[model samples]
Target: MLRLDRVSAGYGRAQVLRDLSLEVKAGEILCLLGRNGAGKSTTMRAIMGLLPLMSGTIWLGERSLSALPAHEVPRAGVGYVPQGRRLFADLTVAQNLEIGLMARQSGPEVREQVLTLFPRLRDRLGQKAQTLSGGEQQMLAMARALCLRPEVLLLDEPTEGLQPSMIAAIREVITALRAEGVAVLLVEQRVDAVLEVADRVAFLENGQGGAVMSAEALRADRGLVDRYVGV
Candidate 1:
């Protein structure tokens, strides 16, 4: 489980998140939906310790994520996939995954698990990341994060710009992760994807989180989406 309590963070003196609070429970997906500048990505950065918090705390169960250095946050069982698939472009798929394994000191067994999850990556192990297609690159990024065997996973726009088939593949993987008891915090613009995969949805407005409602509820009342995320 992961919890962000009244978290406020931003770049320099300009704050992006203002007292934002939300939680992701184990074995469930919590999708974050909002307009472009509602601080969705900022929430992920704060949780990853990529941005320093001005106030409040982020907790991974009993562990204080805000207290950890950016580098140490992943070691504490948090895996992140930023908006851009920030992979080592020149490295081979296997090599990129190796870096993730090294981060958690994971072994061959972990690599095997990741490869199994992303069978496409198995064949592309020796291929350079930069040479892969967008969908493949996204798969590599998610696979690398899974190598950490993370308890909490932060994924920002994982399905962005992918074909429908690829998006379905990514969604399937996320759903599988939830079944395996990983706490997922997903920042997604695709309402259909969120409705299919998320257990609950949290909307942000001006960097603050409103009430979290069940995915089923949102599906029943479509107006909520227009109100928070707009058309």
Candidate 2:
């Protein structure tokens, strides 16, 4: 399991997350929902070691993650897909994926697994990342992360600007990751989209997420959906 033990983090002098504690269990999808400035992205940054921890700790099973540097976090079995599909647009899909292979020096076998996940990538290996469509680029970004063979995956706004078909494909990917016992912490705006794949939901309001509940409960209560998630 991946856990944040009352973690507080921020950028510069402004603190975004305030005493936030949460967990993403193995084989489960924990969706994070929040409005703008709710600190959902900040929370993902804290877990990925991109932001410094102000207080408390983060854990991936028995290992302490709060103190690790950003670059080292990937080797710690944490894969991250930031918003906007941050790929090397000028590079070919194969070259972009090679960057991820450098993290663990993984062989061709692991690379093959990632390619298998997104067959579209297998065909576009020689094409520059910028030439691919939005959905294809997102798939490449995710495939690069999977190339890391991470135990925990953090995704931010994956469905943004995507069509329904692409959203369904990403949903299948997340569900497959869960079935493989890879814990996923998903930061998404679409409640229905996340709920379709998520086991639980956490609402981030005022920089805190204390009310983590089962997806079933959230789905059953229309009022709760109105109160916490307007989108």
Give each model's whole-structure lDDT.
Answer: 0.94, 0.90
What lDDT tens digits, residue by residue, belong to model 1 across residues 99-204? Answer: 9999989999999998888999999999999999999999999999999999999999999999999998999899999999999999999899889999999999
Q: Give the residue spans of candidate 1 off by over 4 A.
A: none
C-alpha lDDT of residue 76 in model 2: 90
Prediction RMSDs, each to the true structure:
0.7, 1.0
Candidate whose TM-score is highest:
1
**Most lDDT-accurate candidate:** 1
Which residue pairs overlap in candidate 1's backbone?
none
Q: Stretches of candidate 2 above 4 Å error?
A: none
As a whole number from 0 to 100, the lDDT of residue 231 in candidate 2 is 50
